[model samples]
Target: MVFDERLVMAFILENAIKYGGKARSKSVLGKILSVKPEYRNAIKDLIEYIKSKIEYVNSLSQDELLKLYEEYKDYVKTPTKAEKKSPLPPLPNAEIGKVVTRFAPNPDFVLHLGSLRPLIISYEYAKIYEGRFIVRFEDTDPRTKKPKLEYYKLILDDIRWLGIEPDEVYYQSDRLELYYNVARELIGRGYAYVCLCPSEEFSKLSKSGVACPHRGQSPSENMELFDKMLSGEFKEGEAVLRIKTDLSHPNPSVRDWPALRIIDTKRYPHPRVGVKYRVWPLYNFSCAIDDYYMGVTHVFRGVEHKVNEEKQRYIYKYLDWKEPTYIHHGRLAIPGGILSKSKILKGIREGLYKSVDDPKLATVPALRRRGFRPEALKNIILRVGISPSNAVIDFSLLASENRKIVDRLANRYFGVRNPFKVYFKRVSHIDLIKIRKHPDYPERGVRRFEFRDEYISLYIDFEDYSNIISRDPFRLIGIGNFILEEADKQVKIRYIDNDVKKAKKEGYKFIHWVPVDHSIKCIFIYPDTTYEGYSELNILDEKVDSVIQFERIGYFRIEDLGRNNINVVFAHD
Candidate 1:
């Protein structure tokens, strides 16, 4: 079997550039196997051949390699060129400039990628129709899923980071009285009754399609019981205000669901309004009341909540109030993300996570800390565009979108991870060398490095040292090409030529290098872990949160800045 040597070389060089100018043998061999699976027997020979050619390939100039990689990558991937720009599907029964949407978060934790779907879609639809968008905190349950006081502002910050400003913000904690009045109205209208049956008996009766004995109580009698329950005459779980529904309804869950329940506020007080009220409204009740009272025209949410919408409709019909236009899109599953608030809180307590900004989690702060752009996130959400089909997105797709946005703006510099010192002997003595801040944008200016001493010294990537042995002549990146005299613990080289084109003619690869004394400490943080390394000194000048490319390494965002050391989060290659 024969292969096009040029195509093979292109694949090797492209993968090498992707991995900080040091292409691994396994990676190159795997590419071959993927394309030519029948070449299973030739794996050993193919790896040897690839290793043999890497020396020459490794010597190619950074600019020349990237150009080749880009060309070859385009041929292999053939990426789509057009972007979706149409407005979101129009909300049903929504009048122009009159549609209102709300993002009601529980406020127990920061918003996850799943949560962002509704937040972005609702806000976008509201904008598309020039309607009002509201951000409501549904922190009604002060017991099981307690609200974090700090998350209130953090969630707003996350929303603002996505370039959205809610027209109004409301907390359900403040609307306890409003919910009480609504529950009273339901009782007065003979549509609700206070049930004191044991939970086990109630479950049995509900399943048997039998009405509770309390269901026959008069409206006035039920109203007094509800008032007594609210007035602290009832202990927690002793009585609950149940919205009366047909017991024979096909859906058993919709059969007489509980509305307002007595909660011991003294044990678990609301974060914002503590211990003042003992009666608390459940999700269906509080959410329904707020949606109707706040005039929400559209309720955009995941299909998982379709049942909740069904239950809420009962309340709406009984009160003669119109339910919001409920748009239930299919679930959005983001693989490899910690979306559960309980799990995240547990992880935080166990010290498995540092904070909400921990890169391992998919919290808004984590994405932001990991250098994910708001525009990229918003664009991905927009492209998905309220599709009813269950949408499963890979985290890599988000990274790909982010790379596109940051590529144009990120300035370039050299970063050597796992550094191996290479001392060039018989080299030309130069005072200073200037490297382009960005290869494509010369107008961005240059990062100047001055050698106070006479001789040039640099640290090259440890993996690229094999190139020095396999390729007879190689270029020292911004420096010059040299011939190896002695290759051992430390490389001994003699200057052969200073002309890069001359070396390029010989198929030499240029490796990224940094002066031993001129580099600064850099901590490169990955999604899963951290790597301590060195980068160009000028990177210290980058402000925190500014994105930059570490030349052959990849794009990274400056997460923290200090006079002596800087921390960067890896964005993408």
Candidate 2:
């Protein structure tokens, strides 16, 4: 028996739309076999065919899935109880109303795609439990990971764009006194000490599992030095507050880790508060304190921070405070995009990148400007979830998701690149050509072009013309079939009957064209190259940032609308 590929695709689309845009092969195969038992005998051959169909269906956007589902829903089988499940797992030990989560971002650089996992995970868990979500700026290290003033707002804006509005916002810089108070209490409790030893010397002692000289100081003596350090008696790198941990621990960095450090704020003044304080708390120190005080119950961070978690746990243990539930997921990597903040900053400084929002980078702002929907990004993150194994974001998958969304909404337009003029003989002296704005939704209306000459002249993409030049007859989309008559300096054709069905029946190639006299200048800007072209004059009505499909080409987002030409960015096919 021949297996119906459409039936497999229907199940895939149904499963994808039902379960966050991803379809499981096993589930699709199970459904197929359940409906058609005979197909089970030929499973070996059908598996690869179903796999390919699933791949194609899973690549569609939510809108595309819905549309495709309409066409094939009759073939889809009802989902079984085992197949019905939530996309995201419930947060461990989370209570509906009492749960709280925080996404702590350092304002040193604007948020990027790498930042989305924690941000989205934290926000999602908060929503799942109907709890409050907090956005904390871990800007305590003003000297090294210096927080820029502009980045705080930009980060907030990016988060908002991703549909995450924090219930409360906190800045670690403003809570310096709180952190200092905690440090003093820890020092008094003999859980921490003020170390005047140089970093190089301290590192050697920590690595060798030997105690620093300052580790033996009395609580009173340590307090005195801590006061002096805060009063500007200690220069940068001269003194630091160390948490007392197991010196003989396996991880040398976790042995007596530095909690607070004195910075020469006068030289490297903070952007927020210039030289107001001489000492600042380190990441583990401030984060541990804030998590407990700010009611953060769950901490979502990258697996790379596993050691930091161990170091921070010391503070929680010493202070007798309950630690928040830590969920460490693997890091997210974009193969071709730069995700390193330091590298991106260096690139910007060297003028390799225009800004954080440069199209070449994978920063959130950059992706946003490049016409990638925030929903698509969220969908990708949710699909990857809290898996400990690192995930690589495939550009094709992202483009497929974006295409699904923009395909239904974006109006179709005719854009001819490196246009070649073609004249059609035996055409009416005057005629009005009407084309639907959207092929799927005809109610959206149509764009009209008035032809005024006996010979209708139109411009088509040179590449399209080249491919169809040898064909005796080709169909002009939205117009009638035409036969090539001449191919001199000026190309010519003779118009035939307007039988689109005949063209389709014969499998004739169709090419889009714009009226020679009533077309708008267009420039399609890609990452590495540009395509100068002419689009239908109706495109002039499209606003900047509007995504539209150039029929026979891919989707494009209008970037700039100039008096002379419209600049659009090629999104995807």
Candidate 3:
């Protein structure tokens, strides 16, 4: 069958969304995975091929592209060239070089769940190599950069809280002149050309391989045009300095891509450089220059950057800098996950979620709130170690791993919801009873749950209610005995240990409950949930965040302190 990228991508995405989260049939998914076991590999190959094709087209002059139409067409089929063993020209004498790596999140926003795997694995590799880790900001785009204001400081704080701090901090805005000098060198070496391409027009040129009027300009003339561009000679995007390279070499990024453009954008004023600088380097150019200038020895970024890795070598060649050791991990795309940052951002903006860290979203904060520890995330991501075989992980794997870890250390609590009073006959005259908070470990912490005979509450799994009838022994959880009561409005019985064991052996349904008789006054949230057995259970809510626990009831958090009420209960789901 012919490979159609859009069709395949759409199909994969559709199935991912449909079957994600137990939302679809497993049998259907089994058939699908069987049919396309290597779908992700297929798409990844296509992305690299496209990246190379564009670089090939961009390396030529406008007229050069016209000469290479046939080559461009052939290049599109496949761009996998042999891995050339070209040594880094800058450090030819240094063999077996030691190198440092980094994960440079700017901390402007909370990390999207999409970013988790990269951040984790990079840190893991850095630890393994015992290399210095740096956290740098590509904060040159002031328009989108967050200022270090009170409200904006959460990003940095969150990164630290997650235990991934960098060994060093740096910012691109701190190194503008280095980039400008390198661009100047490219211009002088006939390795870059000045083109006054508009951003709107160039987005097409990005793939079309069609150069504009100034592509044929001589280096002398290009140098003047380029220098003028740096001095704010033209409006933003009205002119750009395009790197001169082989447009037909089968790599689109190497094709005369723009390295610098006028910097007057509609974002905030540059925090350091300000409006004084009228030209800014594009991502590729800036990265090349920074990697070289900062003495970076090893470069690691998402595998989405494989094309960048190849084309970036052009800069190293142009500037006479050594190419850093290259490693590209795959971007994390979890199965059954909403794996897009833009989607999460849209959700936050559209009120589908409260914020980037809304518990409903699978952001780090949500995970923290759900009783999943940051260490669990680290453990899951670093499992296979590092390799080029970077695959999108299944979310179920991470979730399952998290549950295993959390289930071990987290204290257990009992909570009941949609509660009705289970009458404890005459024994009810006794208004108070103290339930040992954690039956398994008493010394871990000292907290007693207070319960009254008149108002004891327990969560009878709506399923359990359907499975049983009246006079079930009280299930004291670990203490023993099942509650002998109807799944009706409510049922009550003595907290007996032996009968509970008997019910368990006979396959009797036992449920969860918070002893309502407690004086601590724990508020059961979602106080309005439907009570038809345990039919409308909310499990997703309970799987996010780390801090909240609801004993046997489930995980919970305190949203707001009620006036005079010391204990507030909110559902994790």
Candidate 4:
């Protein structure tokens, strides 16, 4: 470690300029130009770089973030590795405990439904306790790896959008040498052995707890064998680092697990490092090493990761590090369907759902775009509460929860779909298209309607009016006045669109409707079909999903049809 007084003086000098005599305030700047022993002054320019951009930093926009990468690389790098300038705060117990946690996500694809929950829980736990939560990309699978890194931007943006933004970021690919060093250390200590067990015999070995030929080797012999494995002297699957443990024990940790595998380094160069090495640590090993190096104190995740935790604890024990607190929660599963990312991505690739934001799935952002508020989702999850059992919840429960949040919120509108047109020759000259926007809540206000007697028509849904056999007068919607007029043997009925101030005067039945002419090109319909609802206890579709409502229509958001086609999934009524 070389000592450099000029560097420390420079850092303090820079901090003094930024924070007056409290040079301690600019911790990030102080660290950058620190003239400390073993600290390099090469990074001193980082402070000047930061100082030069007081105006430009404020000017930074998300759109120009990528472009600034080349110019502001240090601001980015500093956060990951402590650009913190403030001196340590006084400890509560004469000992300040630092707790670190990482939200490790595999970079195989963009985030999906199943991935967010664990990350959300982990992030909150870390944040609430005033601990560090780092975002680390588990990018070991070379075939699925990508260089665009744009997905990372989306991941961070979505996290921010969800209000669970990560504090720092790390890439697992950046630490291959650390993993290799640790792997070699394990081999030297006889804790890990190079197991050259053939593929045909592995299933027999794991299931039956039987030892293969390599199980009896000495530590020296194992080290030589490991060296061969790392040198690419063995085929991809021919050799692996098997942690020597009690294969016969009931716990899976006692079962020998592969720590490293020879991979095709050429094809899967580290996105940042590029083909620097060939042999690589598997997820379990890399994860364990990462947790130890980063001093992670807690790991809250789905019970699905419980199996990994079984063996992972042993690695922590071997390294003499404190095992992170593990809290396994049952996954949030919706019945009648699975939340498999592969299956969902497969469906998207095959054009099954149109895009990841398909209406059917309760995808976080999709739920948002479809009008599910952020706190609405959190409220839904909280109301569902904690359950230990493998539970299967109906989507209806979530829809109901969401509905409660948006109630009395947006202006109501009438949407007439599966259209059946109606006209009355009697009302063409009537100047008043009388209406109240909301019948129940008069204070919500109203919009005037237009009626051209001969041309006036109402949009009636196919399902409700398909059988127009009602015995009573169906109120004319939107116009607020009506007479049932007539009903066929089927449930369907035909009548004049009405204008009304009270239910008894206008007619007993209420339906939704839209005026023929509106300023918008879109057919902005409200809940014309709320009158005929599903047999279910709650009329949720009229309340949730793809529709966005402008008026107090039981169904608010009526999707518009392009010129060639109009299609809607049936309202589960």
Q: Distance (Å) between predicted and true CA of 244, model 2?
A: 0.6
Candidate 4 Cα errors over 4 Å, as ranges: 1-101, 109-113, 143-154, 202-212, 215-231, 251-254, 265-277, 346-351, 383-387, 425-446, 452-455, 463-471, 484-507, 519-547, 550-573
C-alpha local distance difference test of each model: 0.82, 0.84, 0.54, 0.55
* Candidate 1, 151-201: lDDT as tens digits: 998999999999999999999999998998988888888999999998889
- Backbone atom clashes (below 3 Å) for every candidate: 7, 0, 70, 44
Worst 10 residues of 4 by lDDT: 87-96
Q: Any idea what lDDT model 3 has?
A: 0.54
lDDT of candidate model 1 versus the reference: 0.82
TM-score of each: 0.82, 0.83, 0.69, 0.66
Better of 3 and 4 by lDDT: 4
* Runs of candidate 3 exceeding 4 Å displacement: 1-97, 106-109, 142-152, 198-223, 266-276, 426-436, 445-503, 517-573
- Model number with the top TM-score: 2
lDDT of 4: 0.55
What is the overall TM-score of model 2 with all chains considered together? 0.83
Give a tens-digit lDDT track for model 2, residues 442-535: 8989999887677878998888788777866789887788888888888887777889999999977798998888887898877556788888
Candidate 4 lDDT, tens digit per residue, 1-573?
222233334444444444533345257454643322112333455445545443343344544534444343322222221213222111111112255666787655555545555666555445544677888888765544443365667667666776776777888778888887887787777788888878668757767888767877888998888878777788777888887767886754448888888777686666656776667777788988888888777665666677788777778777677777664556777764446667767888887666555655545544544565556555544333222234455767656665665555544444444444444344544555544444566885565555545545455444434333354445555443444444444222334444454556734655554443431223332112123221111112233344434332332333333343222222121
State the RMSD for candidate 3: 13.1
**Candidate numbers sorted by TM-score from highest down:** 2, 1, 3, 4
- TM match of model 3 to true structure: 0.69
* Residue 129's lDDT in candidate 4: 48
